[model samples]
Structures are given as structure tokens and as C-alpha cells.
Target chain A: MINLPWPSGLLAQAAPAEVDYIANSWLGIASYLIAAALFILSLKWLSHPRTARRGVRAGEIGMTIAVIGTLLIYRAVSYKWIFIGMVVGSLIGAPMAVWMPMTAVPQRTALSHAFGALAAALVGTAHYYTLYGDAAIDRFTMAILAVEVLLGSLTFTGSLVAFGKLQELVPSSIKGLPNQNAINFSILGAALVVGIWLTASPMQHWLFPILIILGLAFGLCLVIPIGGADMPTVISLLNSYAGLSASLMGFVLDNYLLIIAGALDGSSGLILSIVMCKAMNRSFTNVLFGRMEPSAGGTSDDIYAGKVKSATPEDVAMLLEGAQRVIFVPGYGLAVAQAQHTVRELATELERNGCTIEYAIHPVAGRMPGHMNVLLAEADVPYDQLKEMDEINPTFAQCDVAIVIGANDVVNPLARTDPNSPIAGMPILNVDQARNVVVIKRSLSPGFAGIPNPLFAADNCLMLFGDGKKALIELVAAMKEG
Target chain B: MHNLEPKLFTFLLATFLGLEVIRRVSPLLHTPLMSLTNAISAISVVAAIQVMSEGHTTFNHVLCTLGVIAAMTNIIGGFWITDRMLKMFRREKPRRD
Candidate 1:
């Protein structure tokens, strides 16, 4: 019986131990409600580019409240372990968020999903351990816990592998993958069978670890065959898995809040995955098994290197000076270089010079969907000035100068010309149809899909090589000088 | 000041963290995430309803009804919002093509 300090006469008649416990409990609950409100507000605010930063802050507040509540509720031998966990998580997470290059944003997103999955899995495991050897625990509870743990672990490992692939730590596309679909299906089937077995015999705890392993393997199999281009879909699918795991864990623990939150996450993740699939004009099944290997015997370097012609900033500036209509195509490169402000400045200058400037946005530009929009909006680019691919493709033909910044596959002509190309038949921005094209890029590197674009080598195209941010600033300066 | 209070606190904290994760990832996932989170937040409805059905004080009953309504709004509103967003993504077939 631990003695609790409370206001005098508040709980004088009650046992000191119970009084203290109750007070602490109430404190915890109050924190949780506050956190929930913040969470809801954060999500609502995040929907638009205007409030995204605020949304991030709100989310942080909620997470802080949650961490505080968790620490207060759990009786530990010492606070050392809790502090250590917090410190370590922050040390790793902070650098990853700030220092990580925008080029590696996809991998970073995947890693974040893995962290989320790991947290859910850890919670589920802790719940199981807390109830270990309790015969009174029902079968349904055990089954839910097992499922949560399995899915959580699977999502964790799968997201890590995705991160690896996206980071180019692993090859972007692997070839000679015959009957990959059969292999993926077989693994999934085995995982399901093992999951059933684990649920049937919770007393045999060894099956729990085996189920986790099977799930892990299944996640790897599911993601490994997927091309780098399809990473957005894969990340979304893993997010769903993580959410489902959390929901199942909530059910096991009879926590209504957990169940609600987890289910929401899972369903949304699923929907997003479907949306990404649609954006790519690919089905979910095709995303999983479709291995779009670069053409055999044609190295990535061979396809892009020396084939393209370069232009100076002065040349690009002169080209822009005479152009009546300039269409800007922004891609991941713009985001990586954090060139939104510079791009916006250039647009403002162009507009001031009486050049009709319009931005062309592809559905699948940048690492995430709406990435360009968010970046552009941050730089105060007008919403009406940004045109979707379908709306602007026809207008490009009449434009005098098409300025492509860090965009490759989305603007590539190979998608239309090469029958064997992985990106074949995908509708691309018709920047090629423009009178003169100025491609701003850091280097002649292939896109995430590892496919070399022939548009850079086209007679109409002049590659302006430099960091997107630097190039845009120089372009703005040159325009001002002219 | 009760055991349940601490549980509530934990729930709130977890909810906030979960929401942040959703927010950061939402641009990638789109409106479906919002709809899903809305559904998850709706769990308060179940809690409210269960408390009400248990035949607690009249205050509890009122609270429960409010919870249910909030949850229903989240579910119905979420789906409606998602449907609207999906409509935005739809490509109109070119007349020539």
C-alpha cells in the first residue's frame, strides 16, 4: 500500500493507497482526452497545405501527452528505462527527419511506417506478456493478440525492406523473377495457415514467434517484387497492415480507443493504397508482382550519359526572355533541392516580364502524392496557376518554352515510343510537344524506376545542369539582368 | 481520481500520437486516412452507448448519445468526403480518344 499525497480531507476516509492511485488515474485520463482532441484537430488541419505545419505541431502535442500518460500510469522500478527509450527514439527520429535528403524521402516515409508498426507490435507483445499463464483469458482475446503481433511485425519488417529499396541500399528492380506471383501467393497462404494455427493453440506459445516470422517473410515477398516506381502504393499498404495490427491488439486488450484508432488507420491506409494504384493506372495485384526491369544489356549509364546536350544558365535565361508562354514542370528534384521559393520567385519574375506562366503537375510527381502542390503552396504559388496533367497537356503544344525541373519519367517520351518500356502507355505531360524545352536537372540520373528517359536527348530539349534551387535562383537573376 | 481516469489519459495520449502519424502520412495516403481516423475516433460512441445501456445516471445517458452522434457524423461524413475527393481524381475521357 503506497501512501498517496492528496488535498487534505479530499480522501481522508478512503485508504491512502487507493486515493493516490485514483488521483493518478484521473490525471492520466484527462491527458488522454486532451491528446485525442489534438489528434482530431491535427488531422483536420493537415488536409490542406495551408495548415499542414500546424497539423504537425498538433500531432506532436498529442504524442507528447500520450508519452506522458504512459509514463505516469506504468509503475516501473526506475524512470531510467523510460527516459532512455525517449532519448534514443528522439535522437534517431530527429536526425532522420531533418538531416535526411529529400531524395530519400520515400525511404524515410517507409522507415516511419516501420517505426509505427514496431510500436504497435511492441504494445501487443507487452499486453500478451502481462496476461501470460492466465487461464481465465478467453480464446478470442488470445487470437486477437496473436493476429496483432503477427501483422505488426510483418508491417515493421516489410516497411524496412521498402525503405532499403527506396534508399537504393538494395537494387531498385530485380530481374529473372519467374512465377513471382505464385511465390508471393504461396507465402501469403502459408502465413494465413500459420496464423490460424497460432489462434487455435495459444497454449503453445512457440507458435507465436513462428507466426511472426511467417508474417515477416510474407511482407518481404509482397514488397520485393514491386518496382521502385510503385513504392508509394507499397508504403500505403504497409500503413494499413500497421493499423490493422493496432486495432486487433486493442480488441485483445478490450481498449475501445485503440480499436477505433487502429481500424481508422487500417481502412484509410487501404484506401490510399488503392488511390495510389489508380494514380499509376496499375492494379494492386500488378503493383505486387509487376517487375518492370530495365531493358536487358542496356545499362542505366549507357542510356542517359553523353546522349543529352547541356546548356548554360545564360542560354536558358535568353530562351525564357523571348518566350511568350512558359510552362513549368516540377518533380521530386524540386522538392529535394527545396527550390519551391526560388521557383515561385522565378514565376513571379516571369509573370512580371509579361510571360504567361503556368505550372504543370503530374498526379504521381515527387515521392508522395500532392508533394509538388504542398511544396508550391508553401512558396505561395497560386492554386489556379497549377494545372493538372489532363488539363495542361494540350496547352503545352502552344507554349513557347517548356521548363522541366527535375522531372523525368513523368515527362519522358519513351513511355509512348518504347513498347517494352515499363512505363509504357502511362499518360505523361506533353512537354515534348512544346516549341522549345529547357530541362533543369542536377545530373543525367535516371528516375526512381531506374529507367533512362530519351526526352533529355531530344532535338528540342536543352538540359540545364545544376541543383534545382541554384538553377532557379540563377534563372531569376538572369531574367532580372535581361 | 479513479482507475478509469488513468486509462482515459492513456487513451488520449495514444490517440494524439496516432493522429500525428496519420497527419504526416495523409498527403501520401489522401482523404481515406481522414475517413479512417474519423471512424476510429467514433469508438467513443461505443463507449458512450455502452455506458448509457448500462442504465447509469441521466448525465451519462446524454453523454452517450452525444458520443454516438459524433461517431455517426465521423463515419458518414468521412465516406462522403472520400467520395468527393475520388471524384476529383477521375479523368474525363477525351472526346477524340
Candidate 2:
């Protein structure tokens, strides 16, 4: 029989006897190189919203190739458990992706960090015992494993705590234990010492579990003292930890793909942490240690004291009806009350009346970085209509009306005027600069930072008291009627 | 197996590359960026596979099982969520022409 590059015969014939390739093999190396290129391309494509979907596509393709390539490298391992892992994971993961509401994205992000970290830590633990059985572990590999497990375990628990806080399953307030910072630092210090000791003497089996326990302990210690308002920075910092652990896993396995991907994740998290810190105008230390300094700025009653003017939905409708330029400042309240879509309806109604509408998104506004953008974007608001703090701050002056929806600290003029206020140095939306300011909130209750917003009491400001979504729906109906 | 020179070099170079490549991602896409990167780091699935290849022991089986499942979850969820999020961001013209 003449050789025809025999199609079906080749696939079925060679499938059982084909040469297995490791990452160092020519084909495996090529696959890794291609995967790495795709990853870089994935991140690069995210430079604009227009190209972001393409980024996701590139990432999915890259991941598939990496997984297939890794699977082929070894056949001695039992594939049964690995197969079940993927299947069970998909069963859980798919629904989470399909059914989760967009507003739940923060908790979703926190959960991702936890799972990633937990996976890395588990792998490090397995590597330790596998080598220890054969008594062939080396100092360098052991050292890298120690770092990997420490980072992974700590981040795993820390991220879980963050998820709990975001989900409100755990109390979000700081427990304010005495010498809290000192205790946290010492726990971390002890973990580092144990990790270093285990590295030098790999035979000390007792030290290994202790190292892991200390790491797990420090994770809770690190996140427990931070309040809900500080979650953005805390989450970002945990992201960096998760990625760093993965990078150390790379070093242990000598897998260049793991190193590249983990490093990318680490740097991405690092940059986000910087952005979040700058947005809040607080350092990592201040946010983590204690940022709840009493604001000598006094109480909400002192600021409001009958100076506030209350308005109804019809009154807000009339104000919107007369406004030519309107801006919306949305905060965590908008997310809590699920008012995003309704607010968009209100904005659309006003836009039809020839009012130029924009939404000023404070970077740390909702709960995490880009929180408001995700909520507003999910409502089908055009990307161009969503403006960042820096871009929209100056434009608030030209705005005929600034509508504050479930937003407080971001629009509080006290940040700029009162030096003694806790939020004084943080940059705020210049909502007070507008000709008329309307706030939609449930009550005069203080925001997360527990400070009164002076803008609510300003001469040009009026409070529309009600639930955010209900207020928006009523105003939308009123706008349609008029 | 003892030489660590090449691995260290690869890690350093890759990290610097990461710092450079990720600097340009739009802040607007940060939420998606996090999801995608978290998924990417789940490449630690490769590490789990390595661990599973070791001689079968109860401890090894237990560790690798947990490792694979956790990593797989991140791998699946991260990519799924990132794509879902990106799909939400588009320029919708609410303009009445």
C-alpha cells in the first residue's frame, strides 16, 4: 500500500504510540512560545474597550494550548483525578459565570483570588511530600517552595476573608484589637523565620506544617484589621500576593510558562494597587494599619442642622426637565440598592430632552477598582458617557445639574474645604461646582468613612430622600409624564 | 535538576516583560483585567499535574486532587467571567436620531 499520509489510519494508529513530548521537547517548546505570545497579545489588546473582547479570546486560546501541552508531557500520572477536577470545576464555574449578576463582580473577583491562591498552595504542599518521600529535596527548590506556600496560603485565606466582607457574610468593621499592627507584623515575621528555617533544614518535618500554619494565620491577621472602606487596597494587595505565589511555583517547577503568566498577574495587581492608593490618596501602610482617625470635622447633625433642603421625585423631575447639562455621581449605595439600570433609564429620559448626560465614576466608588464602571456599563450605558474622576471633575462646573445617586464622599465638598476631615486629601468629584446639586439617598446617614458631606447642606443642593432605585424609577416616570 | 540559573533568569526576564506589557491596560477594563490575569495564573494547574506525576501516595493523591480542582476552578471561572464582563462594555448610542 502506498503511503498517503494515511488520514484516519494515522490519527487512530499513532494515537497510542506517538512520542510523548515534554516542555523541553521541540514541539512542546513551540507550544509554550506560542502560548506566551498569545498572553502578551491578550494584555495588549485590552488597551481599549473596543479591543477588550479580543483579549479574552486570545487568553482562552492560550490557556487551552497550555493545558493540552502540559497534559501531553507526561502519561505516567493518573489522568482520572485530573479529569474529574476539570469536570467538577466546570460544573461549578460555568454557572458562576452564567448566573452571577454584574453587581456581584467584586465578590467574584475576591473568590477568584482565593481559588488561585489555594491551588498554588496545595501544589506546593504536594511537591514537598513527594520529594520528601524520596529524600531528594535540595535547598534551593525547598526555599522556593517555602515562599510559594507562604504566599499562596496567606493569600488564600486573606482573599476568602475579603470575599466574606464583600458578601457581608463576615463583619466588615475593623475589630480594633490592641497593638493590632504589632501582632500582624510579628505573625508575619514568625512565618518568615519558619520558612527560612525549613529551607535550610528540609529534614525537619515538624517545621514544615508550622510554616504553613503560620502563613495561614498571618493571612487572617493581615485582613482582619482593615475596614470595608479599605477593601479596594486590601483586595489589590491580595491580588499581588496570589500572583507572587504563582511565580514562585514557576521557579519550583522550572516551567517558563508559569513564570511568565504569574509575573504578568503580579505586575497587573501591583499597578492596580498603586492606582487605588493614589485615588484614595492613602499609602498602603495607612490604609492597612489604621485610616479611621477621628475627623475633627464634627458630626452629621452639626453639618446638616436644618441647612439641608429636601425635595421629592416630582421636584427632581422638574429640575432634570430644566437642566441642559447633567452629571451623575454614583457610589456604593447605587450598587447596594441595585439602582444602576433604573438610573440609566432616568439618564436616557433626560438625554431625550437634549440634556448632555455623564456619569462621574470615582475610582474606588462602588467597592473595588472600576466598580461603578462595571455596574453602569452592565446597564448598557455607552462607554463614552462614563467618565473618570479626573476627566469629569473640571466639567462639573459646566454642568447645569449634578445628580448624586447613592454617592456621598466622592461629592462631599468637605474634602476640599475642611482640612481636619478624614477624607480631606482624597480627590473628589467636583459635584458642588454645578449650578444645582440633587442628592438621592435614603437618609442623612453618614457614608462608609462616617463623615458628613458639606455639599448636602450647600445652598444649591437639595436632597431627594428615598431608596435609590425607587427614586430613580419615580423620577423616570415623572420625567416621562412632564 | 540542581542548577537554578536558567529558571531564575527566566523568572526575572518574564517579570520585567510583565511590568512593561501590563502598563498599558485601560483602567476602564481593570475588573476584566483582574479576572483574565487570575485565570492566567491558574497556569499553576501545570504545577498540580507535576505533583500528580509523583509516585502515588495517599498524601500526594490528596494534595494533587485539591490542587487540580482549585486551579481548574480559577481557570474556568476567570476566563468565563472576563469574557462575560467584556461583552457588557460597548458603545451603545442612546441618541434619538
Candidate 3:
């Protein structure tokens, strides 16, 4: 809006001077303030499940108000393209919401960030060009604009890579030429240097395009080396970047509500990223700089070297017969194998046999934080049955059977005993402490941490070698037969 | 930098408020929280609309149109996905087929 070159002659013919003044008057400020308050209340309400729906509703209302307020104050001369855009957007958005499986939610989130950041980048680019004609380049404004575009451009491509990784369009592991980390850092460093130079000299017209290219390339590089295991942190970090860019865009436009709202978004995303890093027991640097360190204590070779006990579905069903309490631990493998429904069915059959069932969710389990919760919730698992790491750890000791469905490092006892292991100090569900442990997996393979799990070799642990979904179906059938 | 005092103040205040508010959200809602934030950040759609409606040149129109399309997708998709996710969080047992 700030960048659109308004023709002075046409503006005089469109509306009287008095009408223009009232449009920007106290009414507009009051509406924006109210919208801001609603946004704050919406976030507060979302904090608890009891009021989450209401919170979502509040946010919707706030967005509607913000859109409407902008319309009232800045009356557009034409509405043709706006209507077309809204219609097309709804057409795409509605079906996507109705049809996308919950398993694809992480990819959906990354795509959303990509779109949002693209918008910000376009706005920043438009602003630079429009203001350049007037030569209204000032040091402070130039610096802010540089940051806005830099963050926006990087987030746009960075989020796309994240989407590709989550959707598996690209390999989830480090791809491309070797020395990939070095190349990525160099792109980032070059972007920063170009961005700084542009900030100092806004009129260096040729430099702007270079800055944009560098930024987009840097985003691609920044995310390419990161594997899917660190997806939560990457997604959260990208969200923070998008939010900060929007906030800086607010400054360039001098819109107070945009500033407040964008900053709120930026900070929340930053906090989430930090929390996600801590949950994995890794610092931001380690996650970014260290390609996942292979666990020192165990490897796939070591897994086969140790004695691993294998069991059949019938054996697991028989073990469950007299079990009073069963704990289900899920990991990324369960998601990859699309086994949530089958696992739920197995739990239900077990419950009918007078067994109690609960889910033990590691804080960093699955690809994203709370990913397992979404999977289970989609399969209609009761909310009460899913317990957080702290809430469920103690219960594992009393658990008659802990069925680890395709989980690995999170249950690795090396975290507790081996100080040299990559995942040392990270809290794991004490599934190994259960009287009996059954792990359903295809083979003796390392997980995201690239670690061999000692839990598989434990005295009570029985490995059921098969795909998660097929194995769960077999277990359910055996349970029904028994 | 000194001239940006008001904007900086707003930024700091909002950052503090955001940290406080987000901490209260249960981990179960982290996904929804993220989607909601993505939607709000697309508030720049307001700016995009202004640009399109006030079109001066064909080039400007094209740029703004792209902005409108991208931001609208984010806003619409973000909200719809969030609502769907929140619906799944109901405490009542989902009806089994």
C-alpha cells in the first residue's frame, strides 16, 4: 500500500478532500487497536485446550477486522483483481483443508510459510522501487528495508526446501556435492555481506537484485544440509524469519498494528525454536552446524553384533493376555509406515481384553514437535491416553508391557549411561524399565540420531521384525484370535 | 537509528508480550499455534490489496497481483488448516466407524 504510486490528478477526481481525511481519522486507529487486542486475547486463549476453539475463532474474527479496517481506510479504486484473488485462494484453501491427510500437516505448514514470506518479499521489493523514484532514501529506512527483504527472501526458499523435505520430493538427508556445509555457510556469508552493503548504499540499484538472488540462494543452502530429523527446529526458525521480515515491513510502511502483530509472531516463533532445540538436547549451533552426529555407542553393525531376541505377533499377543497396563511409544517410523490407525485398533482390542493402554510421547519424537499427537488425534485416539514425557516416564516402571512401535534413539539407554553418545542428557521414555518391552521395527537400523538402540538387546526387550503397519495388523489379528 | 525509536519500542513490547503469551500454550497446540502465526504474518495482504487497487503501471499491477495471490493463499490456507487441526483436539471420544 505504501509503495503504490498514487496519481495526484486522478485522486482529486475520485473523492472529495473531506472524505479522504475522515478515512484516515480516529476511526481507523480505533479499529486497528481493537484488532490488536483481539489478537493478544486469541493467543492467550489458545494456551489451553478448554478454550482453543474459541481462541481460533477469536483469531479469525481479528483477521476479518484487520482486513475490513484496511479496506475502509484505504479505499481501493478497483476491486476486480481482489475478488478474483480471494475466489482463487478460497478454492485452493478449502479443498486442501478438507483433503490433506494429517500426516502431511508439517509440509502444509512449511508451504504456508513459503507463501507468506513470498508476499513480504514482493512488498519489500515494490517499496524499494516505488520510493526510489522519489529518492526518499534515508539511512534508517534503508537499513530496515534491507533486513525486511533479506529475511523475506531467505524464508521464501528456505521454507520451500523444508516443504520438499517433509513431502519427500527431495531426499530428507544431506544431498548435493560434498563439503555441503561449507558451501551453505559461504552463501549465507555472501548474502549478509551484500545485504549490509545495500543498507549502506540504497541507491546502488544494481546491488538490490544481487541481494535478492543471494538471499534466495542462501535460504536454499541453509536448509539443504539439514535432515528431516531436525525439521521442527528448522520450521520454527523459518517461521521466526518470516515474522521478523513482516515486522520490518511494518516499520518501512509505518503501520503500528503491523509492527505489534508481526513482532508478536516473530518472538513466539523464536521461543518455539529455542524450546524445540532444548527438547532435543542440542543447541541451535549444533543443529545447524553439526550434521547429525552418529551415535558412538552403537551402530547398525553393532546392533547385529549383539544378541537380539525376535518374536512373532502371536508371541506379543500372548504376552498381552495378562498385562494390566500397556504403554505405546511411537516415533517417526510409525508415521512413515502410516500405522496410526492400525496401532489404534490394536490398542482398542487390547483394552477390550481388560488391559489399560496409554501412549508415552517423547518431547522430540516424530519429525516435528507434537507430531505424534497430531497423528494419534487424527486416528481418533482419546486425548487423555496421550501423555507427555514427564507425565508418562514414571508410569513406564509400572507398565506391564511397553510396545515401542518403530522407535529407536528415544528409548536408547545410552543416553542415560553413555556420556560420549550424541544424544547424551536428552530425556527418553523409560520404556526399557518396563517389565517387558516389544519393539516393532523392520530391522536393526539406526534412527535419526544414527544410533543403535541398546534397548533392543535388553533382557526383556523382544524385537518384532516387520513394517510398522503390517506388524500392528498382525498383532491385532493375533489378539482377536487369542 | 534514533529516529526509529517508536517502532523499536513497539517491537520490544510485542516481543515481550509474545514470549509471555506463547509460553502458556500447551505443547499439544504447538502445531496450531504455528499455523495461526503464519496467517497473521500474512497481514501484508492488506498492503498487497492497496497496491493492486491503486495500480499505476502494468508492471506494478503484476507485482502486486503476485503479492495478493501469495498472501491470500497463506492467509486462507493457514486459517483453514488451523481450524481443521483444532477440531481434532476435542476432548470427547471421536465416533468410530
Candidate 4:
């Protein structure tokens, strides 16, 4: 059989032979290039909701091509193990994809980041051990692998912690742990120092596992103190870490496609985390250190005492009846109660009654960035009616009734007025400017900032206290009847 | 090309391209966009494949198998969920004039 090498143009055709070295090589490169293009196109397609599905198709196809290309290149001694893995993965993953409610997207996303990072970490470990045993590892490869494993392991545990917090399986915030940030920094510093040591001396096999342990410990410490309000930034940061780990693994394994995909994922997560931090007027270090100030102070009663007016569902319905334009401000509480559908129902009733309906979306609303949009979109809320914070803030005064549903900080007037507050200078929905502000909340409980909202006590604001879903349902029924 | 120089170049350029593309994605589609990018990144399963084929030891295969499973799950689950979520974002039918 005749054959060409890596640079040969005749790679489109290959002679049949054992291993088929040149044939597989060209095919691999071709597949990776096509997959890379497809991946880029996939994200590009997401620029609009109308074209997003095509993007998904592109991503799916890209992944398919990459997988098939790998199988073509490396013929395992026994494909059974790889086959079993794929089958078992499909069995577990398909249900997770199909059964997860839209409200659980953030948790599901965190879990996936964990899985992806863990996978990369394991592969890197395997490669490192294999080379160590052969006594053939190089400095560059070792250094990159050490960093990869560190990042991958931390990302693995960080994403899990994030998932746990989002699932409420663990406390979302653990503050005032006495030098908590110091402890976290030390743990992270220990892991990095260990990673550097591992790079210099690959013979000290015990150090590799120590690095893993420290990485895992640091991830836990890093995420535990992050409050509920910082979830969007935390999740985005985890996503970025997971992607960077994978990218570093790509360098370790010399995989072109992995590098491109990882870079894309990393940059995407980076941009989102930045956006989330900006929305809250926070820095990356503040979120990284997991420092949130939840003052259990006298503000709640002091601000809310005699100034508050608690109303019934019927009162809210009556207000809606008289209102021409109504805007909804949803938050984490709405997600917690799974009240998006009920809110949609209320919006429909309002629409039918000739009331203009718009949803005001704060950038940092819900458990993650854009989370509220996904929930509302799932409820079949028209995309056009979902107005962003800046777009809708100026129009709040024209709104006769601003219904704050399971929301707190985003609509709090304090974010704009109080410079010393935790959420100070954060762009809020400006719901107070509306003629009548009705807050549908469970109670006078403070939000993640652990501060009382002055909006609840304003003369124009009426608190309709109840479970979010139940309250929205009652209001929807009343709206229909009225 | 001789060292990791070309790869570093590729990585930087790809990340820059990603930022621009992701920036344009409507905030409304951020959830789906995240899932899609993650699924694409899970293509590191190909690397896991290469590792599994390297040595005949049970330890290597086991680790590689587990790695493959994790990446596979991310790819399947991520794409499937992203597709489901994107489909949920719909526009209202045109109203009568």
C-alpha cells in the first residue's frame, strides 16, 4: 500500500492497510476542523432566539463528528469499556436532561460543570501516572498537567458545591466563619504551591494526590460563603474554571479541538461572570472571597413598622382591574416557589383585560444570570414583553401598577439611594416610580442582602404576603372574575 | 509549530472570538448558550478515547472509562437540555391586523 504523510494533499483518498496511519491522520484533522467551525457557528446562532435551535444542531453535529473521528483514529484493545461508558452515560444523562424542570436549570448546569471538570481531571491524572511510570514525562507537559489537574479538581468540587447550594441541599451562605476568606486563600495557596511543586518533581507521586485534596478543599471553601445573591457570579466562575481546566487538558493531550472548545467555553463564562459582577456593582475578588454582608440589624422593623400596608389577593386584583399597564418583577422567590406559570397566567388575564403586560428582568435576578428569562420563556411569555432593566426602568412611571412577584432587592429603592448599603448603586427595576406598587411576597423577610427593603414600606406600596405560587394563582382567579 | 507556540496562538484567538460571539447572544438565550458551550467543550471525550487506547492496564482503562462516562454525560445532557430550553423561548403568533 502507498501512503502520504501529514502535509500531503492526497489525504482525501487513502489506501486500505492495517492502522491506516496517514488516512486516520487526515481524517482526524478534517473532523476536528469541521467540528470547530460547527461549534463556533452554534454559539453564533444563539445571537437570536429565532436562530438558536440551528446553533444547537450545529453543536450536536460538531460533537458527533469529533467523537466519530476519535473512534476512527484510536482502535482500543477492547472497545467494550468505552462502549459501556457511552451507554451508561446516555442512560443517566438523558433522564437528567428530559426530567429537569426549567426552574432547575442553574443546578443542572452546575452539575454538568462538575462532571465535565471531573472527567478532564481524571484523564489528566491517568496520563500523568502513565508517563510517571514510564519515567518519560517532560517539564512542560508536567507543568501543564499539574495546572490542569488542579483546575479540574477545584472546578469539580466547586461546581458540586454550587449545585448543592442551588439545589438547597446545602446552606446557600455560611458567613462570619472567622477569617473565612483567609482560610480559603490559604487552602487555594497551598493547592497552587503543591501544583508548582508537582511540576518541578514528578517523582514525588504522593504530592499529586495531595494537590487533588487541597484543590477539592479550596473549592468547598470558596463557594460555601457565597450568598444566595452571588449565585450567578459563582456559577459563572465555576463554568469558567471548568472550561479552563479542559483547555489546559487539551494542551496536555495535544488536542486542537479541545483547546478551541475549551477557550470558547472559558471566554463565554468569563464574560457572563463579569456581567453578573457588574450588575451587582461588585468585583471578582469580592465574589471570589465569598464575602457578603447580611446585617441582622434594626432596619426591618424600623423601616417597615407602621409604614407598611398588607393587602389581600382581592385588593391586588382590584388594583389590576383599574390599571392600564402592569409590569412584573420576578426574583429568586418566584423560582423557589415555581410560580412562573402562575405569573404567566396572571399576565394573560391582564392582557385579555386590555392591560399592557411587561416583565422587567434584572441582569442578576433569580439563581443565575438570565435564569428568570428562561423560566418566563418556558411559561410561553412572549419574548418581546420581557424588557431588560435599563429598557423598562424609564417606563415604570407610565405603569399604573408594578407587581413585584417573589422579588426583593432588584426593585428595592435602597439600591439606588443608599450608597453605604450592600446593594448600593446596583441598577434596580425602579418599581417605586409606578403609581401603585404591589409586592407579592411570602413575608417581610429580607433578601440575600439581609437588609430590609424600603419599597415595602413606601406609601404607594402594598404588601400581599403569601406563598408565591398560591398568591399568584389567587390573583389570576380574581383578575379573571373582576 | 515546533513547540506549543501555535497552540497558544490558537487558544488566544479562539477565546477572543468566543467573547465577541457570546457578547452578541441575546441575554434571553444565555441559559441555552451556556449549556451549548459546555456540551461542545465536553468534546474532550476524544482525548479520553486517546488515553484509554494508550495502555492495556486495568487501572488506565478504568480511569479512562470513568472519564469517558462523565464527558459523555455532559455532552448528551447538556445538548439535550439546551435544545429543550431554546425551544421553550417562543414568539407569539402574529396578531390579526
For this target, which candidate reaches the highest TM-score against the unseen true structure? Answer: 4
Per-residue lDDT of A166-245 in model 4, one digit per residue for the tens? 88898755553789878988988888888888778878889988988998888877877777788899888888888888
CAPRI-style grade of the A/B interface in model 2: medium
Off by over 4 Å in 2: A1-24, B1-3, B94-96
- Report the poorest 10 consecutive residues by lDDT, candidate 3 chain B: B50-59
Relative to the true structure, how large is the alpha-carbon lDDT of every model? 0.63, 0.83, 0.81, 0.85
Task: Give one digit per residue, the lDDT tens place, for model 3 in A1-482.
Answer: 33221233235545565656454534566677788888888889988878887877877788788777776666643466666767776676667667888888889888888988998888788777766756767767888888888889999999999999999998875555578778877887887787778778878878888888988998998888888778999999999999888888888876767788788789878988987888788988888767665655645566556578999999999999989999999988999899999988998898887788899888677777678888898888877888888898987889999999878888988889889988898878889999999999998877887777888888999999999999999899998899
- DockQ (Cα-based) for each candidate: 0.05, 0.57, 0.56, 0.65
lDDT of 2: 0.83
Off by over 4 Å in 1: A1-30, A70-79, A293-316, A333-352, A373-398, A412-427, A432-435, A440-482, B1-97
Clashes in model 2: which pairs? none
Considering the two chains of model 1, state its CAPRI-style docking category: incorrect
Residue A375's lDDT in candidate 2: 85
By DockQ, the candidates rank as 4, 2, 3, 1
Best by lDDT: 4
- What is candidate 2's DockQ? 0.57
Q: In model 3, what are the clashing residue pairs, if there are any?
A: none
Which ten residues in a row are the worst by lDDT in model 2 chain B?
B1-10
Q: How accurate locally is residue A97 in candidate 3, as Cα lDDT from 0 to 100? A: 67
Clash totals in order: 12, 0, 0, 0
